[model samples]
Target: MLLGRLRDPYINYRHRRLFHVLRVSIALTVTFAVVHLFPLEHSSWALVSTVMVMGNLPHIGGVLDKGRQRLLGTLVGAGIGLLLISLPIPGRGVQIGALVAIAIATWLVFSSRQAYAGLMFAISLLLVIGNGAPDFSVALWRSADVLIGTLIGIAATLVILPHKATDVLRFMLADNLDRLARLYHAHTSATSAPGVDTRELLKATSALLVKQRGLVDAVHREGRLSRGEVDELISYQRRMLSTIELLLESHWTTREGHDRINAMQGLRDQQHSLARDLGTLAFQVRTGQPISTDISPFELHSFAELAVGARGTDGRMLFSPSGYLWLNRELARVAASTAQRLASLERLPSKRLRRRAGRHGLHEAQRLDSKEGSQNDPGSH
Candidate 1:
């Protein structure tokens, strides 16, 4: 019951919202504290921008990235400022050319994944056009100020309600496990249309990859996940996602092609099932006891048995439409794999098995209660 509530999509969203709000609040407090304490009379605009940028850093990795950008931008802008100040020629042409070069550099960096390069490029340009102080002094002051702000921002981000990337990684893994369960449900229902929707499955798989990237970035920033562990987790996620894609597209081919594809699909489904089970087992290991299985791919056997029983019944059949036996065979392969995953998990300590079974029993009870309520309802008919 508790695990189901934790996994609830609506509950997940609420937690996400609360986390975001907390991060924002911390950033604001840090910005105000810095501004009041330092009281820099001159470059208030620059200070304000730095505060805004620093305050919204959602994760440590992002904070570091912005800091790097600010540093690079300051140096480049400062160098330009010095050169322009030293130049005997005060021509507008020279200034325009310098500005253009800075713009090009910024664009090039921005094209890459370093989002902070644009700011750095702009800062470099600003330093080049200093009003009173020599370009070197202006550049020095600007760089120092930006560095101060960046440090303050990073400090605030790391200190305030500090979160571990590992938690996010676990959350994402849990979500993926849930998605896998849904996919199995879709497969066994016999209602999933003859051809699986490759696009929809791929979209979900792509989102998983995005989350993996986020996990990597978060760990890199906070040192929350070990490098080896991050690599292992990411590699596992990518392999599983690719395998799922292959399976999704396997059903749409010629007869000879179908047979070869079906064999591959069998292996693919088995791998997915094993992976999901391992993930569940890992969670159990982490949480000190095996969580009860609220959802099980193995239970999908009931659906598969129903399909087999419906075979050869005619066009009015309830499951696994023909001309699609190859597809159904592939699905059976997937079910077998799912069963293997559950079995592997069961082989762990008996305590885990008991806990998992206990959860499944609870879910079954709830399901029965729901059915009874529906049957009793006048509107149900």
Candidate 2:
């Protein structure tokens, strides 16, 4: 029973977090051992460098990028320190003034997104100028220590349970898609409980979008995803979110006439079919598999026909048929596009495949939307 109660925390612990902890522990241990064994000056600086470079749960790509930045920063900083030390500025006030100016410049660089280089510059300057007299030799030694620590951190990340940023990106995308599918179903289903909070679903989607930006940054830092791929993925996610918002709006507009609409056999069948397709697509995304069905277009343009044939014509449904058909068509397009995006990511090794996926996905969506629009209202086309 005691063990059973203790299981919750273990069960809740994320694999990513576990691996991150392990990676950091190993890197720090190795860094400490190296500093103690070697005749390196300022061994504590090495430890600090290792900690900074290792970061917390760094992706393989991020580790490499950070290491590179740290090394470059150290070299540049050392050079600057040496230059400053060699300068014949007679007064101590002038030297201090120069140091302060350099510090301000470093801060500006850091704020402008070149954080790694700027940080290194600052460190080098401080190390050389901190004493009563500037010491180029000490600055050089400190730079070497930083470089060594950075290399160790990079090696540990590469060799010890290395986590790929791309994998995290994939998992996050799949999870969000799954949630979106559920939200779509809930909004469209007439039988969904009154307690179902659409607001919460929207909030979750918004949060996922914010998370996606961070994931993209991580992937970029790791050097896994190219600019084109990142842009495509971001565009697809935004379109999907927009489509969901449209679906939610449709649901609210039709809620008052739910019984009458649900009573219609054709409309109900189409909604069910679309919901099933969305769920299947969600599953495919989660599993990193291609969707079996080639979601071609709204094969049935019967919404207008069905509405005209019905006996009792209500104002609530007057503009609703067109709106419903348009919304459904939009949903289908978004789903198909999303599926293609996933397939592209799956076969991401080939640049040609990615290009084709984007081209074909957009073409297919446009064709479907055009066909539906022309069929529903010929003038709009």
Candidate 3:
């Protein structure tokens, strides 16, 4: 009941924002107190480092990543700063040139996955060596303060209103599958408006898939999902989306060819059936459970054939019935492949959301409860 209550308000955008605001406020307050408590010069760096770690990423994975980059950058920059201070440079110009070179090298790596690390490295270097006095003790203090602030940020993120990436990813993936199912039904429905603009919808779905890339490591660490399993799931899902896009085409054939294509049997019903399977897959993904029965592929009969070499006597490749048939088969193969890949996942029990919370996920709870009852029944025992 407590979990249910927490989730209800957490689902609200305003409430989520409030949670983050409170998190940052609490973390900063503690850091401020500590800064005043210490008898060190340049203590303001602590507060700055805390905000740097906590400002953008509210999710656990993102915070962990930012915290790691900040710590690494601070340590490396401080070490280099100490080394540079000891070097017998000819003049201030040489020192300045060396700093510039370091800055340029760091900025060049900003386009890679370690982009944040590069920025943090540059900032750390500047903090350590940029002050008028290049004192070794001052550099050590700045590095120490930065580390302290980063640790505080990480602690606050973990203890106060933490949003684990695994949990977020589960919600995201389930929602994606459900949304795709809705799109499938809408696009394939007989009542769909003519010339409907589905481009935006497709673009949005693809964008969500891209967002999943960051959370991949979270699942690996928290859910123990194998890299290959994650790749297959993502790859097949992409294939499914691409297949749907290809299915939206103007027939490259003559009137007779178009008629033959339209005459294909059971395409509409088959679409609806496939959408249902997609919905089921969404449920399974949310709960981290396998379906009792396997999701079967579309029957070959549904793939209606067109006449061989559909061209008007001019030898133009009008409507390649074979190509049309091949696409349908590809769609079926992809859909089936997606289900099979999902089923193949070696999901750890710990990965399952056992909480009977939230209206959107009640089915998983109810089903699990029923299964538990069966397991404990006296007659069964």
Q: Candidate 2: lDDT over CA atoms? A: 0.63
Among all candidates shown, the one with the greatest lDDT: 3
Cα-based lDDT for every prediction: 0.50, 0.63, 0.66
Say what the RMSD of model 2 is. Answer: 9.7
Candidate 1 positional error at 230, Å = 5.8
Stretches off by above 4 angstroms in model 1 are 1-17, 93-97, 100-104, 107-110, 127-143, 185-205, 214-218, 221-381
lDDT of 2 by residue, 152-213 (tens): 88898877766666656655665666566566666655556355577887787678777667
Which of the numbered candidates is closest to the native, going by highest TM-score? Answer: 3
* TM-score against native, each model: 0.55, 0.75, 0.78
Where does model 2 exceed 4 Å of error? 1-14, 92-112, 193-201, 221-223, 249-260, 263-265, 288-293, 305-317, 346-381
Cα deviation of 94, candidate 2, in Å:
7.0
- Candidate 1 lDDT by residue in tens digits, 310-349: 4332434333223244443444444344334433442222
Could you report the Cα RMSD, in angstroms, for every candidate shown?
Answer: 10.1, 9.7, 7.3
Q: For model 3, how does the per-residue alpha-carbon lDDT over 81-168 read when each residue is reduced to its tens digit?
A: 6666666665584368447757775777757656777777767777676643558788888888889889999999888776666556
| Candidate 2 TM-score to native | 0.75
